[model samples]
Target: MPQRERKLRGHFSTPPLLVEQVLDACGYTPDKDLSGIRVLDPACGSGNFLAAASRRLLSYGKQVGLSARTLARYTHHNIWGFDPDPIACMLAELQMHATFNSCYPRSQALHRLHIHQADGLAFPWQQCKHVDLFLANPPYLAAKNNDLSGYRSTHLRGQVDSYLLFLNMALQVVRPGGWIGLVLPDPVLARSNATQERQRLLAETTIHHIWHLADVFAAYVGAVVIIAQKTPPHTHHQINWRRERWIDAVPAQAADKVSLPLQMVTTVSQDLLSQQPGAELRYLLSTIKGTIIERLQRQLHMQGNSQTPRTLACLGEYVLIRRGEELGKESALLKSSAPQPNELKWYPVLRGGIDIHPYAIPTASCWIAREQIVKPLDRYLAPKILLVKSAGRLQATLDTQGHVVLQTLYMLQLSANPTSQPETQALFSAEDELYFLMALLNSRILQDYLYALHTAYKWVQPQIEQHVLAQLPVPAQAAYTEKEQIIDRAKLLMHACSKSSSVVELKAQSYELYEEQERAICALYEIALQQRRVPDPPHDVVDEGVSLYG
Candidate 1:
């Protein structure tokens, strides 16, 4: 299929080995009885799961002394599949025929297989009930791009993927005791957009296992395989979550070896997941790290204020925040080499995240013509803070040169009305306030808080949102003596960082100073950090072998 069509339809074929894994997860063992077992693949692309399931049932039938004709009849009647593509349905039917011939040769009876071309989401549920297993890799379309009006409900809203809707529909059609094994995108479990659906899934089903598969498909999209049962919500049940690294290429032979190295991250209880507002199953954090981080947040919430500790003034309250302007296709404005004349029109431009750091920018390689600069040109000439919008940590630096910055950076300037109270102006000058804010923004405590709240993976590329930045707690009317000391220390730290020889040395020196400042800030905020062991970094394993089934 063409790439464009595949994207529009969200059609990606499952590898045979992965199909076998899903079947195994659904409890389709060859030793078990094959009679009266009904399997349905809602989005059965080319019938991979159906083909695998049919072989398993036939193998079980042979073990139980069933004749070839009877086994073929049972296979045709028991297994059900649905796909929107007629060609895929035909291909799936062909696969089933091949499976029947391989398992039960010389069976003259024509098998009436239940594979049809139709939208699984719109399939009439009244026609089928008591399904034993529902296995699928449903279409992956965003809600806005596709016609999902039939599937839309309160639980499914706001850019929810089509696979999630398929999962929900499967739950409704499957019997109470039946199982659902699906391969879905990872965001379904973690993204805030899927909060309602996640909550519904947790409340309705008992999740047996979840495996995070990194780069499992040809497109290298992050995915997860969830094996869950349609059971009444059981708060005490523990869900197993594991991470696996699969080899990139499928094995050539059925007997070939494939490495599926697995790591047990943590098992979470349904009660805890249900209690969370989003019901976010964030298993990325290890047991010790999660516990300690939660404790710190709770302490900050309880002890930081007498009445409402959760409420804190955002950074925006004290500064004007604006994103850098994008210089579109105006090649004349930017020069590869220095201008021949050092005119006022040529100003240094900071164009990327690499040029930004904690307290200083290391380099400015490009210069822009000031005449072509976007609106608010005065912002480029003011003493302000520059923050890299797309960095894992808060990459903020003091830009005193009035350098023009590209869209990758955000500019922060002190608000025009610095203080509403005239008496408070004497306590801290604007420069002193900028230094203090820089110190807090670059602190390890604030970094930890942002990471815990916004990221799901250890090595996340977090984009600092304006609203999130504004929530930083500011000291309310501090003593002049302590405020002056903090400002002095911040100034020294900034100077030392700018003078450092290399990035590594600058980070080390900056961290040492940040820790010292954090202690004083913690005292002012009345927050305490508990001593705990930091968890080991997550393991990244690579294994080269043949497929598990092969």
Candidate 2:
């Protein structure tokens, strides 16, 4: 995107303090030889990176007894910048000119500093092959309108983000052992579309460090700055990750003083990240959190047939997941504003993210004809689970009352095949199974799994995708007593939810029971319970029989 467009849209430009931090994090400073660095910002808009290089060169010159005029020539020779926007290109060149003239204290405009108004993605191969450090904040645009035929990720017909092409470009541009620093939207770290690029990154570079901008880029625009060496990751190489956010400046102090907030750091082995399923990297988890996660996913031998008897039963095998569709012809679909008037067989539609709460459904003000829906009507009419897709966590309810559901939710239909596991078939009827599955999906334990594993992806909208919901771990409650207990609790909550009389007391009772139900499901999954100390008769309040969890 052009800098002009970004300013018009109210998005942030690179802060000077942030530029300094990014430089330090990537080992780019006056401590290194600026003349030999050959820094390049492929997506430079107003040349923030080029200016950083200029500052470093001037600082280096001061230590070595060289004048600002001498260093201005060095800045003119070494830094390179490119942008597709001609207006942006002129501004970037002006930015470089301003940097050089700052110490000279001149009003003259400088020209011809190796900066070009061309697509960096299509920069000359000869020049790019010699770049030492590729540093830039590329556009967060999609590849929808561009001709990506020349890029590697798009060469094989793979659709990718525009920033991904910049990453691919960096690998070819930066020399071996050279560094690449990029400020990217957070999805680049964990999205499925970027899975191949991440795997390639581990195979081709030693990802040295990351800075998670904890909502400084807006909560919806979660972003991170990644620094890596072009060299392949070696065994025992660890990745440094830190959490940093923005803070408001005090009225008494300079604004720059509070621009960089306090940071929390963690280190994880590069091998561990490579080992993670699909190479999906996230903020490093602590030991206690890691241990708890391990237990949640640990394979347990439940009562079943001998084939893969020791494995934790897969959730994907039990149900067919269907994503709801968008209803654009609302005027045609609308029959009445009343809730399921039914006089003309019109059903109320749930089209909002907040339409369904845990174990409950709110009254719908919009009614629609079933025949007007574009998707297969049976999926919405069948006994299924309604999971809100656009939530930070899983919000689900079992829907036996056939409602016209829209794209904001996912409709889960329990697959009842005869060839399925005998225990699943014998233990559950079609509707009973929906309740059991609903209980699991709505549990606090699985909600924790969703966040730690996938759905809480900190970029864009964290909507629950169909594939992610299909992979949620569901314990095979082989014990008849346990299965019945979950279903009974879910039923009690649902029963309490449908009534209109004594709303206050019933809602309170339902929530209290819901929490207890979450606890029971947690126990079923062997999730660790917090330990407490009980006073011994005449002794100190010391450690008692605590849990065996880490």
Candidate 3:
């Protein structure tokens, strides 16, 4: 395929091994008669899947004692495929013919190949409703870029992806109780934009398994293989969600040499998935971690005296969270005019997340011209917390002078109407509250929770959303003694961090003080101390459970 055409159509060829895996998942084997089984690959690129399926069906026919002519007839009649690219359709037909000829030399069934040069998305469903298995590696183009107006339906809404539309099409064309195996982008399960389509899919089909195949493509596009069965409406069943490293679906050597461990797997109830709007898919977590997180939530709720456990209030209730303003053409703004004499009016512009650290802003690296400033200038005049929006670890610091933060940071200030509720007012009281909240935000527990919730893949940067921050658990009301002790420790740590001459020394001191403060806070919330421990040094070297000398 031409590079430009491939890019435009999202044409990534399916690996033969992955094709075999999908076939196995659908219970297709070479030892049984598959004459009645009708398989359709909607976006059959070069007929990779059809070619494989034809070989499997031929093997089955041989095992069932079918003659060469009967096997050839079955291959030509049982399998169908469609692709928009004429070249792809031609290649698919050739592949199927070659596979059948290898199995049955006397049979002349090349002309009966069902591969068609038709757009799968727009194919007439009424003509192909007898499909028993809808298997495909659909195009990955985003809906906005691809004109899917012809495939649009009530279930398909918002900025949909072309692959998602193909999934809906497959559901419609597959007969009741038939199977569907599709290679899809991993985000189809959790992205905010795909929530509606995901809901519809869950409501209509029984998803048997979801195999997350990370970095499976040569292009390194994160992909997943979803195997589901079309069923009557209102059907519900537990979905088996599994995760693994790049699937070595094809063994490089002997089968015994391969060690493909199941990284994680869990059965998820439909009711559980429906409870959250995003269908957040907590099954992705290991069973043990999931249980621990649930227990932690329950423990926090029981802290309150009310019969109904108190849920953690979102951070938005007590604080105004906003992304820093983007002052376009920074070079022009800085060079166009000089600042006035008043230092208060001439605020320093934060360069990026690197300039901010826990409880401290490293230096006044750059200055913004006051006249060129945009709206929310008042935000730059008050004390607020600056959060690094794109860091591996969450980095936040207090900006007492209200510096002009760049777009890379988020500004968090006490809400103007904090007095609207007693809880809000209590949480935002001056110096102590901010210090305590900052301590909790940077704690070990919250850090672990954030990683579980936000980190999708190791290569992807983790982000903090306003809604996620709001749900962070904090003490509903801190006692005066606890508040004073926390504020005092936080202040000391801030002072130590600012005065340190070496970054290494600063980090060591900060971590020590943070641990002390974390213990106190965790105690107040009745949370057990589960801080990760450094491994102890080995006393002696052991070889096969025996000391070297022994």
List the global CA lDDT of all models: 0.68, 0.67, 0.66
Give the per-residue Cα lDDT of candidate 2 at 324. 69
Residue 474 in model 3: lDDT: 58
Which candidate number maximizes lDDT? Answer: 1
Q: Candidate 3: give the clashing pairs.
A: 314-470, 315-470
Q: How close is candidate 3 to the true structure, as a TM-score?
A: 0.77
Best by TM-score: 2
Q: How do all the candidates rank in terms of TM-score, highest first?
A: 2, 3, 1
Q: In model 2, which runs have C-alpha deviations exceeding 4 angstroms?
A: 1-12, 106-111, 126-128, 145-147, 150-153, 214-220, 243-262, 284-290, 298-307, 328-336, 339-343, 418-428, 495-512, 527-550
> Model 2 Cα displacement at 75 (Å)?
0.5
lDDT of 1 at 261: 45
Candidate 3, residue 374: the lDDT equals 80
Write the residue-wise lDDT of candidate 2 on 1-550 in tens digits: 5656563432345656567667776677776666677888888877877777776776777777876556766776778898877877788777776666765666343445878888887755655577788888887766665556776447675678787888878887888888888887788777777887788888899998877675554325666788998888877676888766654334311422343454677776666566556677655433223344544443321123235433245566788877766864255666545743446767767765546777774446577765667787787778888888877688778777787787778888867652246354576678988888888887767777777667544645677777878766665434677778889998887766643331212466577787778777876665222221111222221111111111
Distance from true position, residue 314, model 3, in Å? 1.7
**Tens digits of per-residue lDDT for model 3, 1-550:** 6767676779988877777778877877776668889998989989988988888888888887888777777777889898888989989988888888887776665558788888877756756568898899988887668776766463445677787777778767888888889988766766777676677667667777777766576443567788888873332356777766665555522322333344676765554555554655444433422244444544443433246434344456667787776753255554334455665556677755557777664565577767767857888778777777765466666777667877778788777675224243354356556676677666666666566555452223445666666556555545567767887887777666752232213565577776788788776555231321112214431111111111
Q: What's model 3's lDDT at 295?
A: 42
Could you give candidate 1's per-residue lDDT for residues 181-223 as a string of tens digits?
Answer: 8988766766677777778778888887787776566442566
